[model samples]
Target: MRYDFLIIGSGITGTMIARELSKYDAKTIVLEKENDAANHATSANSAIIHSGYDPDPGSLKAKLNVEGNLLYDVLEKELDIPLYNNGAFMVAHDKDEEGLLQRYYERAKTNGVPGVEILDQQQARALEKNLADDVTKVLNLPSTKVTYPWEVAIAALENAVDNGVSFAKNKQVVSITADNEGYTVKTEDGTTYHTRYVINAAGAYTEKIAKMIEKKVPYHITPRKGEYMILDRRVAGFIQRTLYPTPDEKGKGILMVPQYHGNILIGPNSEHQASLDDVSTSKGGLKIVKEGALKLAKNIPFHKNIRTFSGVRASSSHKDFYIKESLEHSGFIHVAGIDSPGLTAAPAIAKYVVDTIIRPKETLIDNKTFNPCRKAITLYDDMSAEEKSVAFQSDARYGNLVCKCERVTEGDIVRHIHRSVNADSVKAVKKRSRAGAGLCQGGYCEHQVIKILAREFGKTPLEINYFSDQSNILKNETKVKK
Candidate 1:
């Protein structure tokens, strides 16, 4: 079928693009390779909304970081997702490193950031007491923040759909043929997409897609992997704010981050890779994460370590966000080379692409009836006693506590499934409903979650995911005579 726009890759970049198009009168569709949005690097990111502090001067990262940071307050309200502007602190360990931190603060000011401040060690200690007494200085980026990445991605896609954009899951595009009218995209499932525009937002494989075109874009992409460790919320008391250490030539060094989930996250050591599939965690990476956490976190206990995961960044050799379109083919655009503050830049980048690349003069009508607000997840604890009693009576599943670690009930799991929750992978469910992400880490709830998935998704017990490898929980099935 024909669509005005075909966005390949349902990561934050693609999702945001879809949202931008939804504001106009355009037929848009986002094609995701996985079962749902954000199953790739989007689901596994460190969830830091950068303050436009890093990146070299005069780079896209610097420009878009400022623009993207400005939209958080409005976007959070529209999407109904949790956006925590807890701010950040780049703590200097010694007197010698203090000057470097100040330089970063200056960069933020140069970029038109309003609240960037320089604090002495004593002032920093007043803000966060857990800092080591020997600390030299700290940079307070008050606009720094964190958010649930998956929530933002999903909400954007949903809002785009509400404003008229279709989402095709398991639609992995393999090849694109640009023609006089548009491009014909052939997916792995033999589905064909004939669209006026092609957006190559495919995160890791963006370079591969570029090579598919005859006039391939001049670009280079390298995978930079970052691994992280999540500390239990109980350990959050040890953290006064996001902690940081000195940086080297490679990238941002390991540090402690307070995630939106009310837990402390650390590590994410940057490792460059030649291929996208090379994303994996190693004991060496974990060692850096833990040791660095201890050094940066003056009071966080190591016993709080609960989980470890890694995400790969599509680093470009040019150190800038790459957005290119074919001079011969107007509709074919490459939103590649998106790294670092790409998450923060996503919304702004979407608007920029629509204005500069698409230039849909005909479809410039603003959506008058667009419902920007989405319903937040219902929390049982938030309801009053009478409300809980009524809710439990309406659906007994609401009272059935299935996941003890997170106080998740059967009703919560059902809502996730009915909402088209992405559960093809265990991580998908964890991101969607916090099912297996609690303290027990699925040790007590794995079987229960599998059973629910089997019943909801119409899969056999063995068909449900058991681990990251997509292994089934049920070892065997029995056939009995009636």
Candidate 2:
């Protein structure tokens, strides 16, 4: 089918663009390579909405990050996603680090970031008691926030799909050829899509996708891996705000991120990788995270660490965000090399792409029926007794708790499975509903989730995958079915 816009990836940037374009009367479609959306870098990260202080003064990361940080006030309300605006602290361990904090404060002012100030050690320690003993000063950024990164992508894409945008999974674009009318994007599965404007937001694969059409792409993208650790919810209140250990050349060093869903996240030590697929965490990488996290906050319950994972960032040779139309290909837009602060800048980036870049070139009418609101998944634990009774009356599955750690009910999992962007895999379900993302890490509830998925998808337990198509949880049936 010919579309007005064909988005190459389903990450936060692509999905946000899709959601923005859905407000127009254009035929937009988002193509994802994996079996689900946001399975890569978007799903794994620090999940911090940066305050726009770290990026250089006149860069796109600075301009869009400040704008995007403010847009979340409306996005969280419209999309029904939880956003924790608890703010962050950039701790300065000594006098030298205090100088760096002052420089960041000036940069924040230059970038038009609001509500930034430096607090003395006594005042800083008053706000957060877990600071390291050597802390001399703190740079307070009240605009910073935390959220469920993957859930934001999912919510945006789901709202986009509901507003007439099409989304397809497992559609890896292998080749792109320009024609008189438009471009033909052919996937690995022999499927072809004809679109006038192609948006290359393919995260780590952005450079490769650009090379398919333009022989001499201006920039090269190398995948940089950042390993992270998630502490159990029991340690959620250990820190009230995201804590940073100042800035370094590698990127924002290890941070103590208070995730929106009552979990503490740490690590994300940066290291360049030769391959984009190398998201594997190492003992050495994790050791750096453990030691670095100690500098920001003392007496952290390391025993509460529940999971360790890594995400690959699309680091470009340009040293800044490469956002512009291809000089050789008129309609092709490249939103590449969006590494750090990419999550915080996504909303503004989408607006710029749709309103500034695309609209001036092409005439687009408003989609009159577009609705920004997406129905939020009900958390059984958050419901009142009366609400719970009403939910149980409507669906008996509401009474059955599938995930004891998170208090997720069968009804919650089923609703996510039947949403606009369905959760077909165990990981997808976990991202949307937090069914298996608790202390036990799915040990107690994975089998039950598999059973539910089998019944809902009309397949046997062996067919239910953990995330990818090849990573099936059940290798074979142990016994004969009755």
Candidate 3:
């Protein structure tokens, strides 16, 4: 197939870039190696919307993060994604930590961060009553927020498709060769796609993608694996705002994020890994996470942790995010070095690429009729007294609960499965609908979702998958018994 542009990843950056480019009249195609968007780093992180307080002054991360934070209000409304400005509290342990925080406060001031201030122990405690008493000092970033990283990516990518962008899932780009006017990319599935431009948004493999074009991309991605713990909805209101630790040379300390739903997330142990694919949480890493969580709230009850998992960050080999045009190659752009603030910086990055890269092109034409709004299903929590009556009267599936833990309705799961690519995997469905993200994890609805998959895709429940290519489910009725 021919395309004006070919994107090399399905992570958030690729998805957002596709969404950005779709505002024009270009024919684009996004290739995802995985069955779903945000399967790697996008969905793996803690979902923190950073407030541009940590990166070095005037860096790409700083500029983009600051701009991205401001863009969320309109972006969320236009995209129909949920966002919570749960504010972050960076607590200090002692005078030494307080001294370090002073530097960060100054840096934030220099970066023009709004709502950056120091709060006494009493003030911090009042902000979040569950904070440990020893938190004598705190830096309050009132602009800090939380969002569903996976949902944003999914919506953006599908929105791009709605605007004429094509998607080719399971089409892993194995090699790239430059041609007379453009590039020819070959996938593992033996199909070839030709495009004039290529964008490297592969999270951990961004460097590898550049190597395909024989350009020596300088950044090295170190995998920083972060293990997270999800508490039950009953513990959602334990803290009124997100909590963080003071920034230092060791990197930003652990964080407590309040999800948009009535639940809490504790986690993201930052440990460097040797392999890019080493996203598995180690025993020691999780122990550190538990200890960190207890430090914030001693009553967090690690026993209530129904989910423990990890995601690898494409940690910058250098200092800041690298989003620049390749001097060595034309039509090749680098979007590597996306770490903690990448999600917050994504929208700004999209704008930057558009202005610096796309707008200058002679062929690029603006569609005056472009509509940024997307029609997403926001009825999960939007069902008020009147809306519930109207919905339930129209469909019985809305009343049938499939995931009791997350309050996911049968209708929600069915729609998510139909909308999501390769709707056979539990992991795929979760990324789309938050199906198993609640207290019981998948213990309550994994079987039910598999049955739904069986009915939708004409497969037996036994053949259903925990995730793509990971099926080991036991057949409900044994053939030997029959």
**Which candidate comes out best when scored by lDDT?**
2
Q: Note each model's CA RMSD in angstroms.
A: 2.2, 1.1, 2.2
- What global local distance difference test value does model 3 have? 0.80
Q: After superposition, how far is residue 308 of candidate 2 from its true place, in Å?
A: 0.3
Rank order (by lDDT, best first) = 2, 3, 1
Error of 1 at 385 (Å): 2.4
The list of candidate 3 runs beyond 4 A from truth reads 379-382, 420-424, 460-463, 469-477, 480-482
The C-alpha lDDT values of all candidates are 0.80, 0.91, 0.80
- Candidate 3 collision pairs: none
lDDT of 1 by residue, 152-234 (tens): 99889878887888998878788899877889998988998899888899988888887777465667888999898888877
**Candidate 2 lDDT over residue span 239-294, tens digit each:** 99999988898888999998887889998899988998788889999999999998
| lDDT string, candidate 3, 121-156, tens digits | 887877788898778888888898888888888888
TM-score of each: 0.94, 0.98, 0.94
Please give the TM-score that candidate 3 achieves against the real structure: 0.94
Residue pairs in clash, model 2: none
TM-score of 1: 0.94
Measured by TM-score, the strongest candidate is 2
Give candidate 1's error at residue 442 in angstroms. 1.1
